[model samples]
Target: MSERQRYAVLNLPAVPEVSAIKIVFNRRSAIIITFTTPEKEHIQG
Candidate 1:
């Protein structure tokens, strides 16, 4: 299976529309998601 397929299995977007998503797994077994907006797009945080 490819990386894209792994994301699909988790029901996550492989390519986000407006921003980029960063997935982090901490030592505490917690999932952290970070959204980073591009300079070209206007995203309301």
Candidate 2:
């Protein structure tokens, strides 16, 4: 098996756009979580 290449904007097939996004974290905590429909997955799939 081959290793997957990381994401690169210059390697993308189309103009990336985001319709929704969210960033979750506690004000007293340092942890953070992000959730979004990545443009790459959205179109490629």
Candidate 3:
């Protein structure tokens, strides 16, 4: 999937609007989430 779509799937609003995200993993489970702001309009981080 495209990076934008990938991020969108996770509720992220473009990488530029993102400050940071955390990855949580334990044994066989993992997830990524971050706070997003729509201040930027860039496609690439």
lDDT ranking, high to low: 1, 3, 2
Best by TM-score: 1
lDDT for every model?
A: 0.59, 0.37, 0.51
Off by over 4 Å in 2: 1-16, 26-28, 31-35, 38-45
lDDT value, candidate 1, whole model: 0.59
lDDT of 3 at 23: 42
Q: C-alpha displacement of 4 in model 3, angstroms?
A: 21
lDDT by residue (tens digit), candidate 3, 1-45: 478865665674455656655444456644444344466443232
Give the per-residue lDDT of model 2 (tens digit) for 5-24.
32432243532364443333
Clash pairs (backbone) in predicted model 1:
none
lDDT of 1 by residue, 1-45 (tens): 478856664676565554666666689956666656665444322
Q: Which ranges of candidate 3 are over 4 A from the true structure?
A: 1-14, 36-45
- lDDT, model 1, position 39: 54
Clashing pairs in 2: none
